[model samples]
Target: MSDPRHSVLLNTGSRMPLLGLGTGQLRGLENLMPAVDAALAAGYHQFDTAAVYRNEVELGQALRELLPKHGLERADIFITSKLAPRDQGPMAPAACQRSLDQLGLEYIDLFLVHEPGTEGLRVEDPQNSVNRAQSWTALEEFLSRGKFRAIGVSNYIVRHLEELFASCKVPPAVLQVEFHPRLAQTELRALCAQRSVCFEAYSPLGTGALLSDPVVLEVAKGCGRTAAQVLLRWAVQQGIPVIPKSSNPSRVRENAQLFDFELSQEDMDRLTGLDCGQRFDPEDPSLVA
Candidate 1:
């Protein structure tokens, strides 16, 4: 069993591991299997993937092969997949089903809308709002049907979340975004806190750009941890779940060694002070209507 301190209770009464293995850019059984093996051995109980990542099939295969070897079952782990932007609105149901098919899962622990805007639609288009509402409605139906244990959205900003709140019957259980020391996302985090939405983080290492940062390096040195550990620690220490992706087996194991050490208040403050609202992901949800 994973440490209780490493997991948080979602609004849907599900326990989500704060330190998950991100499957973005990790494709093929050859690449994903070892990472999955390392993750499982390192006590990771959560795996996050998306349709856009185009590796759900391989991830499913890897898990099926690796979980038994690790003495684990489907119920012991949490899996998350997403509806692609191309499949928003009327196509959401099919997309959700396809993700389940690709992942080879009877039910995903979480399913998130991968982006705020639909494909081929302008950010300011009114249809985006309608499509988002319809998509959420479809997800709500799936939740009722037990296709998804919890539903959420990714890369959504304040306006996007507010619009969803006004119309959604079941509020989101999680809101995943690119969060790190450089991109603290204070306002969005506060809104999610107020709404009881679990604010989760992806790219917590700033998409590999923050590893060499002087402040991060200094903090890592002070804590005798790797830069990746320091950055991931900054988020999970705040009770924010994080999925920091890496295909290297050693790095995967190394990344999971976050629960042993504690950062001082001064170190935490110094890291938080690095927030300049810098976002590493190219897709800016703020541009979406």
Candidate 2:
């Protein structure tokens, strides 16, 4: 517990950084490059991306160009990307190759199936359990080929994982999901721990919606930290990884400032009690235009 920069151990025994940067929702070289520059300067060593983000090329270029300036190398950083849903079944490995070409990396540190099911590519047609098993087969094939060090899934629930584990040869090493004080995901957390799968929290700040929460703010004030830091600290303290996205340099720097302090047990309980199963997704009115 003393090491604030501790890495979460995956089933593969590879160390995944507990705190990372999310590159979704911020496309184009203009934003991705500078935000990454700021994140690098802020001491971030991990980055999350996806094929759907449409910034793999730009992100790869930016990191390649910027790393030299900071005297860093690929080994110093951990990169995570995802396979899109449309590329389920036989298309999964091809998509990973395309992503490798886009990122220009020798091998990805971690790669995940972005979604459990596909739209229409498979005969099963958006079949959750079967598609996941099929896509996992592709991932496992490429994984042995040295395309990705560890493979996992995003947006997958308990049942999908159980089914995948039953029929697949490789077990998922990580699970990424939308998490915050509002959506505690306690059962998912328990299941992940039980299976030794490292849980990674996306939108840990609630995509800017949880920063102003009264409960979060109250806990932050007592800890003398910002709401974002409190939330990130809470997630990592629970032995989960968190990726918080921000383009503002100051805010980007501020987002990873969770290592300085520890949240009290009482404050953790208060934050835990704040969970009422609230979630923010694309369907949320506040997110729509």
lDDT of 2 by residue, 1-289 (tens): 1133567768997788888889988898899888999888877889999999998998999999998888788888889999987887767778989999999999999999987667554424435456667789988988999888999988877777777778878888999988888889888889989989998999999988888989999998987899999999999888888999987778889987877788999999998888988878653212111
Q: What is the lDDT of residue 86 in candidate 1?
A: 98
Q: Which segments of model 2 are wrong by more than 4 Å?
A: 1-5, 120-126, 283-289
lDDT of each: 0.94, 0.84
Q: Best candidate per TM-score, number?
A: 1
Reference-based TM-score of each model? 0.99, 0.93
Q: Kindly list the per-residue Cα lDDT of model 1 for residues 203-269, writing each as its tens digit.
A: 9999999999999999999989999999999899999999999999999999999999999999999
What ranges in model 1 sit over 4 Å off?
A: none
Model 2 per-residue lDDT at 205: 90
